[model samples]
Target chain A: MQPFIQFESVSKSFGSMTVIDSLDLTIHKGEFLSLLGPSGSGKTTILMMLAGFERPTRGTITLDGMRIDQLPPHRREMGVVFQNYALFPHMTVAENVAFPLEMKRLPRHEIARKVARALDMVRLGSLKNRRPSQLSGGQQQRVALTRALVFEPRVILMDEPLGALDKQLREHMQLEIRELHKRLGLTIVFVTHDQSEALTMSDRIAVFNAGKIEQIDSPHAIYDTPRTRFVAQFIGETNLIEADVVNVQNGHATIALGADLAAKVRSGPELQAGQKALFSLRPERMRLGAEPAGDNSLGMTITDCIYHGDHMRVQLARGNFTFTARCERLAGDWTVGTQVVVSFDPRDCTVLTS
Target chain B: MSRASARERMGALLLIVPLLAFLAVFFLWPLWTMVRASVVDNTVSRVLPRTAAAIVSWDGQGLPPAQVHKALIEDLRQAEDQQALGETVRRLNSAVSGFRTLLTRTTNAVRDETNSGAIDLGDLDRRWKEPRFWLALREAVPPYTDRNLLAAVDMKRDAGGAIVSEDPGASANRLIMFRTFLVAAIVTLACATIGLPYAMLAAAVTGWKRTVLLLAVLVPLWTSLLVRTTAWFVLLQNEGLINGALQVLGITDGPLPLIFNRVGVVIAMTHVLLPFMVLPIYSVLLSVPRNLMQAAASMGAGPLRAFWRVLLPLSLPGLMSGSLLVYMVAIGYYITPALVGGANDQMISSVIAFYALGTANWGLAGALGVILLLVTMILYFIYGRLSKSPQLLGA
Candidate 1:
């Protein structure tokens, strides 16, 4: 697909601190792409550069084959939804949505009509005359979304727009925003520190760390086949076991899991014989049973079993190596000091060489 | 209330007692006395009690009856305090001219005819025969009057006791009062024009730059008002630094008339009151979120439009308060105008000063002060109403 927005070797610095170092990124049209990372990981800086609020120290940002690095924010034709909503306190809900239309110098009746439709779209029509402070947080968030969407700009940039909401409301807004993105076919570049939010809403997730992109792919791919240890650990809970590769055969390798324990794991092309390999094993993927299932099985003693409402977290140990397995709460009466065979398919474990 | 909360309330009340007592003694007491001075008149009635009582019966058509004359003579003869009699003479003379000599002659004649009974005041002084003089005496006989308050606004009672505007050229109190408002408005506008941008700039910057900008405003505020006015006085003189710089820069062939006029008064007052305008606006600008401007821009507003729509409206409460502060303080300004203003540029404060100190007419001075206080209170009431509205604060 042709790129809608592209950043070519962009670098941003604040005095001596290099925030975004020599970065290259591309966003496709009508794609809900999320830049997910911890704070100070340069995710917001990229969004700001795209919005034209901050300038890159080096290289170019082109939108639709036109250089937009030199453009001012008002001329960029992009809408930004801020973390705190940034609703105009003095203006009513309708007026806040009508600001961009008025800026475009639309006629009074047209602006009024559009503002009404937009407010109605957000189910905030009854609150059109209320001030931002008079509205609840969810209502205010909807107003902000309506305000950003009222202008119908080329693209929309959201900087942690749902970060301030509570859990339930945040989840509800996430779905609402996802439905909107699909309904409008918007090219959105959302910046957030929330991994699940990115996973739930994004068509593509770009995991960022230390001013660099660790990996960028579909949520399934990023989660199942993370390219680096950072991405594996950042996305979800996983146990990284260090092992020495015994041999690489076909697309799989045999690795030692310490204390005479060995497992067959799928290896990437980078893995070789006699090489140290780290493999990621999700806790839920490991099955605990009374009998060994297949090639990747080990008899381990249960160190601790913790009940987690719907699931049981079984901590297993064999010699010096420890591993966790998540099992169904009613699967068995797994207790500490009980011996169990922990098994996993070779496809479930991917050897990572970083 | 619970015992602990009652004790807390008592502690708060105790903390405020000194303030309340100070306000009552130093502020409310003087204010009450001044207001009373404007309307309470007793000097004439006190010295000529019998005359005051008897004059009420005399018809307005002509001179008083013989009993009034006899009563006036008896009152004058019996008056022991020479100073009190002098005050009475001064009060009566101010009402009708030539009462000074007439009262002096009448007092001498009353003393000389002490052995006789029923001495006529008309016979003692021919001026006393005039009904105007008697009318002045009757008008002054009232224990309380609105004469001073009316005169403060350049209105007075005619001989027939109907309210009328004082003849033109008789007094310029009304003119000075209007001028006071005009000067204050001008200074307030100038301060807003300069201070709004200055405060915005101060609020926009950070670290040492903001500190420097604030210090520029604060340094002038910390300086004595008299010293600041004097600095302007030195800088505004024809051969002073401003003119000298202007002449040296060839801005003008001669020194401009920068002093002893409305220009000098406004310039000095604006400079002296600029901090009042800046601080409020600056603090308010600080409270306004910085992202709002960026948000406006991202929504497709240009810099100027964003400022006009977002920043300016948000800063209005500060601007209003600053304007109110500058205007109220400017209206009552005395020293800056006194030193820098010309004769015709004098405001109501100078008029009040002239009445209070120059002529010792405390009633007129107090009346003028009361007018100022009333105007300020009305404006403050309006400001209070405006600021209390949630829309103005953008909350």
Candidate 2:
């Protein structure tokens, strides 16, 4: 299917500093795509450009095949949920929700009915008359969301909408917004610097780094098979080892870890023999003992042991590099300075050759 | 009601006592004196008590009887001996312009009437026979009269002791009062109109730009009122910079009448008081999140619409407060209007000065002052009440 929105060679620069370097992306209809990155990664800038608050300095942004970069914010008709909510303090919840429809010049009774329905959708019907200042943080966020949705624009963009909420409330609101998107079949472009939030709520996550997209894939793929060193290190805890590629055959590559140490890793098509590559091994994939046959094993000394409530984290040292292995406490404790054999399946390791 | 709490309360009261004493001595005492002056009418009645009493019995339609005339002479003789004749004459002359000569000559004429039987008080001067003179005396005889208050609005009593308009030439106090409020309102509006956009700009920018904008708005406040008014006078005069610039621009064929008018007064007052409008609004605008405008824009409002819907309403409290400040100061302004205003453009404070200093009529000044104070207090009360709204705080 054709993309509902496309950003082709989009670039943004503020004076001498480039914020978003030549970027290209396509968003499908009714898909909840999240732009995930750390601060200053230009994640929010993409959302701003799509929402018409910013224009791409060098390329074009098309919505449903129509060029919209030159359009003013109001003319673009895209709803934006700000990080601070930004609900109008002087307006009641109902009036805030009715603002867009009023701008469209809807009839008074129709505006009333639509505002009532929108308030009801957010379960803010009882607070329709309360000003934004009178509502709590969570309620205000719901009001902001309802206001954006009430206009029924072609697209909706949220820029760290839940950044201001406490952890528990943020989780709750996250699920609520996810459910709302599913129910409404709305296309949402969410921007957040929170990795876990993007992993939990996005249909597809685009990991951004230094003004360019590092990787774009599903959450499971991004977590399990990050293409670059930055993505693997950013998404979750990973044990990285710099290795020299000994040989590459088909899709498998043999890497030399250290003197008298070797491991097999799954390689991409670009892998070459004698090339240096970094292998990303997840902590949970590494086991405490050499068990589970058909897995590669490495001898190491236990450096430290951390007692987590649900699991135990053991630090393993092999030569100059340190690796962490998450293991169930029921599997038996490994004391510090004790010798241990950490093992992982060769198929689980990703070789990054950048 | 524990001992410690009671002691704390007493300590608080002790701390506040000095402020209360200061307010009483400096503020309340002067206000009470002005209020008393507004309604205090005692000189005529104190000196001519018997005549005052006899005149009350006489019908206002006709003159007093023969016995009243004899009693009036007796009172005048006693008043001269008591050295209260001059005061009595002065008080009555305030009501009737010729009463000073009328009363003083009558007192001298009646002093040697011991052998002269049944001396007619009206025989000394044909003016005394006029009922208007007697009516003026009657109006002045009240211990506490509304005469100053009435004259403040250019109304006075006629020969028949009925309310009537003062002579057209002298009855400009009402017009002056209207012009005072009009000038104040116009200046307030002008200040607000100019200040709102300036404050928005100052608040929107940051760093040195914001600092420069704020300083520009506030630097005028540091100058003295007279200096600013004189500057305006120099700028707005016929051959001044403004007219010269206009002439150079070819906007006008000749120099416009910019000075010595209501426009000059309003322009100068607005310039002098604009910082008052700008500062409050700027502070409020600074508190308003910029994201709200962006949100409005994202919600399909254009820039002007967003400003109108979000920023203007949020800044209303500041606008109202600034307007109140400018209006209060503008209504009571004397220097600006005195320096730049035409005779008809003078506001209430100018007339107050006229009564207090030019004419030495403290009673009329006090009455006008009380009205102005009452208006300002009522506006302040409304402001206090409206400030309870959360929008006013821009939270």
Candidate 3:
């Protein structure tokens, strides 16, 4: 996997405020990578720097082993789809899609053929003559996508492209974009704050926080094994418990939840004995039963039980400690004030030092 | 309609009553009067009522019959208002150019004679026997005439009542009209060339920078038009700052002809009318989404190409409206050109002003005014159609 695009020690700032701080990142060829974070977290800035719309305050960016930091956006050979589709209003759909080809100074007949084929590929052949205002939201999004793809540049960058659509339409577009990425084998860098969207669409997700990448891994690995507390909390639901490491042996450590409760958990390299640590336990990993065969168990009372469509979220409490467990809907009618035993396999818990 | 809604509509109508009355009195009434004055003439008929009637039956070939001459003498003797008689003489003199002396002398002669019946007007003045004099009288006999309107365009009816162009060197109204349009078009082009880039610069910035740019355009607009034109007048003089600077910079051997010419008129008018061009373009550029340029760049369009394809097209509505506005205002300009232009460079408005106020030829003034009004209406129609397009709104 050769790196197709690289940002080497990049730092971007506006006046005195820094948006990206000494960042180093690599994007492989034909890989779908997403930069996911909340607003003002600089995820969009990284995408913009890659697209050559913004110059880095320091350091350099290279694409295909060539320096592209100084190049203008037009010469960067990357297609960008904006949040609000910036389609040319004065031009019809066909003309809008043919803009890049015409800029490339391609022959007239060839440009027309490419524009027509691209429009047909997106199922917008009937809308070739319509202006962007005459089209629906979803249709405009499709036209924008087609226009960006018609040029077939080195990579495609999308900045919250589907944020304006309704829920159902957004989900549909998410899958459509994923399909397009796969069929074209494009090296795409997508920016979004929607964690689930990044998870469902990207081959790798870079969870960003405060202008730096917290974790970069496959979506499953990122969700199942987050490297930091921010990544774990940002990705999905989890219960974090303050604990002290009691002992460490090989790749696992024993952490004491309280004076009377202790649990064995898998730890990363930074954990050691006699140090304060945070233990992360996913809600779905806990089992609500009197199962004595598990490596860890605790006796608590059900304080609240919330019914989801397919699962039950039972909140349990024991003295000062509180935990939530997601269990099967038919897991024996757990309700508030019902005493229950919560257990989990030690392999499902992760020990965090920060 | 429901009671409440109907009451609301009534309230809205009442709110607009003052505005409607103002438009009717101050705008529409004057417009109507001017239009009527261009084609309606009754000076001859009012002074010589019986003569006007008697001359209608005359063949208008060689001379009038004896009864028509007797009727003229009777009408002239009975015309007691001296000012009214003078007005009639003045109106007829404009056509034949000798009635001022001829009518005044004849009026005195007819009044002094005790026997007022059967007076032969040829006995008083042999010039009256000339067929041209009677022809001028016959031409003036019509209460409604196209003389002023035809004269506005430098065309007139011959003795046989056929329309023909005025003799060469006789009048320069038509030449001045064409020059007015030409000067306006030149000024419009200058404004567009300078205004488009200025508007884009204003739109590209934000915060205080944008405020500064807009203020640069607006400060000039807030000043009086005459004051601005006067400022240009001082600057364009040969011994003024512009020439002094040019001399210091060694751009030319001597001061160029920067005043009382086409160049001076164009420069001053462009400066005076630039805000009209810039404001519309700036507003339209503001409404256009800023990301379109970036989108073009992302799609492999350089700055020039992106501007030509995306930004320029998007801002075209503003450019067109600005050009039309400048052109319309430029054609009607009087003070600037009069102050800064040479005598030969005066536009049609100067001619209209001379007719309206200088010579008091209100008929010709109104006719020229009607021509200008028609041109403005056509341009406004085009502007209305352009603005109605969805593209103009940046949809």
C-alpha TM-score for every candidate = 0.94, 0.87, 0.92
- Model 1: residues with Cα > 4 Å off, grouped in runs: A305-307, A330-332, B49-78, B97-135
Clashing pairs in 1: B260-B342
Query: How far is B33's C-alpha from truth in model 3 (Å)?
Result: 1.8
Cα distance off (Å), candidate 3, residue A261: 3.9
Candidate 2 Cα misplacement greater than 4 A, ranges: A246-254, A259-262, A290-294, A299-303, A318-321, A330-340, B1-26, B42-85, B92-143, B157-167, B391-394
Query: Model 3, B1-395: lDDT tens per residue?
Result: 89999999999999999999999999999999999989889888888988889999988778999888888888988998888888899889988888999998898888986755666788879998799999899889788889889998999998789999999889888999999999999999999999999999999998999898878877877888778877876797889889989999999779889999999999988877898999999988988888899999999999999999999988999999899888888889998889889998899889989999999888999999999899988988888887667764546
Question: lDDT (CA) for every model shown?
Answer: 0.90, 0.86, 0.90
Best by DockQ: 1
Clashing pairs in 3: none
Chain A TM-scores in order: 0.98, 0.96, 0.97
lDDT for model 2 comes to 0.86
- State the DockQ of every prediction: 0.76, 0.54, 0.65
Task: Give me the candidate number with maximum TM-score.
Answer: 1
Model 3 agreement with the true structure over A10-58: per-residue lDDT tens digits: 9999999998999999999999999999999999999888888889999
Candidate ranking under DockQ, highest first, comes to 1, 3, 2
Give the interface RMSD of each candidate.
1.0, 1.5, 1.3
